[model samples]
Target: MRHSLPGGTLVLHPDELHDGEAGTEAGFRYRMIYVEPVVIQQILGGKPLPFIPTGLSTDPRLGLVLETFMQSIDAPLERLEEEDALFDLAQALDAVGNKRRGRRAYDYQAAERARDYIHASNGASITLDELEYVSGRDRWSLSRDFRALYGTSPYRYITLRRLDLARKMLLGGFNLVDAAMAAGFFDQSHMNRHFMRCYGLSPARWLSMLGRQTCTIVQE
Candidate 1:
């Protein structure tokens, strides 16, 4: 479903196929917070994932909670304060989910197998066809089931894993080029694009911000 959310709107988007476009000529600015399905499951104590019917809201209370959560991330707050902010956001989501809760069954085992194969790859290249073959499910079914179970598509999941590896290698003193290549990117430029998209900054900028030294090649 296509949505054109306005400013100050709170969106409760599910792990489903959806896209957005600019609503007006001036463009729009929004802050997004992505919560993993497992985190929500833990919050709900194993309740089936909740589905928000409309997915768009202008609720001021939810908006305030989201703002607080975002602020807590950047602020030098105590660990308990951060936890309290997170719980507030989770509870807000749970309240919405309770309003229109529903569930759909999918091939859990097949999805699990695909997830396991991706984990075993460890920054190696992966393809949907390979996932299908390993999981004994068709590409479309596997993709749907995987998203249902993991809150992201398979290729996106792979990219996230690669990003994780690249971050670790960078912290371990690997240079940008080596870390990018070793983490399954084509080169530094390729990794830079994804790093910017996912983390809102380039790898070099991120490293410098963290005050981590580079190019030392620490022994693993």
Candidate 2:
């Protein structure tokens, strides 16, 4: 979707199939935060997620709420501060958004249980049957609830969690193959594909950027 999103325009639930391209020969630049859905659910307190339509938004409240969040991409936000900002963001989205109602009630507790299971089983191959058993919900409902509440399916969540471990391992100076195995991935290429999809960069490039960021922080 071609949108002339100004600096303060907010886009929500960006799960659609799309690609970014420069509109003009002069290249463009922008900043984005890839927050997980679980973070939003934590602050929303069992409320259904707000769906802000894709494209430009001129809502003043959203712009103000996003200012602090969008401005501090490079700097780290403390836990409390980040939580507050996310809360404001979710509230603003709800204020200007249409409610997305579904027939099935979203079982937040069940999804949370599944999420805990995923984290606990990090670096291991977990099956949907196991999640079903642990969460006490059927496979389809559990998967739907997971995506609605966490913004991803159980399998993807597992993959992302493993990728998180792989990222930490890599940052700690582990070799690529070793890190992949340690993170429960079958091989380096398999890990590389998921890493690129999640991070928009290869492991090597991500590591290089982290090194540069570290040097910049030290110099500052």
Candidate 3:
């Protein structure tokens, strides 16, 4: 379940999923967006990531900053309100990661096709040969583009995306094997390997860490 939460109740971090039931439960609702940590730094008048002295989100100092942003979504007043909103979002994220003073080193656009193709196919075994067709670049060039743009090869990128989907599904209470299969992994082992690689922890351990219980749904 998810809703915009006045944009005030949001304690979002980049790439973090913010889910909750909306004000009135008309139906199951959700809102999904990627909030990058750098956006926060940008809003702090070009300030770098502040020294919050703690890495955990639950830190009271971090909580205060986040609470300020979430609880005051519509409070800031400015002529250029859009700009203010962007800045506000940045401030919120800066509570987590500091902005890189220099230009960001990642070319996020280069991986669009690769990302789309992977998601479109439900995380199938994506070969460079196939990506060449989808992205209109040769294998060698595609590999280069992926690494140069996203800091990882296409294969690794796909694997990571699969892991992301698996994590989301598991968090939503999907069975591990079913989540793996739905994410285009060959089987549970495939999901486990990628999950471990991406998280440095097993799927079950991840669930425990996240305080999620075993899923009841078993997709056929």
Candidate 4:
């Protein structure tokens, strides 16, 4: 029930329970595409769903196409381009469905405890000693396992969590200064630097784009 998936894995769940846990030591960021059953029926000409025995794949080509499909969602691409990307992704997935590979096992319970503590803190500053106390792992081991499982260091993960909170506040009509402070940043400039580095754009610019997009949708 609590299987650990490595990075670059793709999963397909068809008409079954697909449950996962986050805020754990092995938590990960991922992209998901949902295809309706009607759409699947049309694509398969009313045939049964493709039987992907294991429902998992680590094919590099499939990963590349999946990444392209994800980027097409946000990129300023034409509708046809997006469709092409999706088609390619589907084909790549079909090609890898029958292939099998071994799964890797890992033990990171202490690191998971640290991750849970970090989430519970809710953007507050966390110390290494606190993590050690909560997780029973030394700073070095915690840091190593945390990065291995979550793909980021503990300090970076904390900063990313604050950034996420600040982004949400900004989208919910909070001003820059308020969002920054409430998300645990020292000030607007502090949030600005990290936000720009992470998103490749300033908050003001991103917000402006969002406003324009909303206006366009409303007008249309």
| Top candidate when judged by TM-score against the true structure | 1
**lDDT by residue for model 1 (76-187), tens:** 4333234334545555666765655456568999999989998999988776667879999866557657767898667678889999999999999889889988998877
Query: Candidate 4 on 52-113: residue-level lDDT in tens?
Result: 55556656877776765576566543332344344444445555664332343444999899
Q: How many residue pairs clash in model 4?
A: 0
Query: What lDDT is obtained when candidate 4 is compared to the true structure?
Result: 0.67
Candidate 4 lands at a TM-score of 0.48
Model 3 global lDDT (CA atoms, 0 to 1):
0.57
For model 3, residues 108-158, the per-residue Cα lDDT tens digits are 454577667867876666555576677775444455456667665556666
Off by over 4 Å in 4: 1-107, 212-220
What would the TM-scores of all predictions be?
Answer: 0.52, 0.50, 0.46, 0.48
Rank list by TM-score: 1, 2, 4, 3
1 versus 2: better TM-score goes to: 1
Which wins on TM-score, candidate 2 or candidate 3? 2
Residue pairs in clash, model 4:
none
* Cα-based RMSD of candidate 3: 17.6
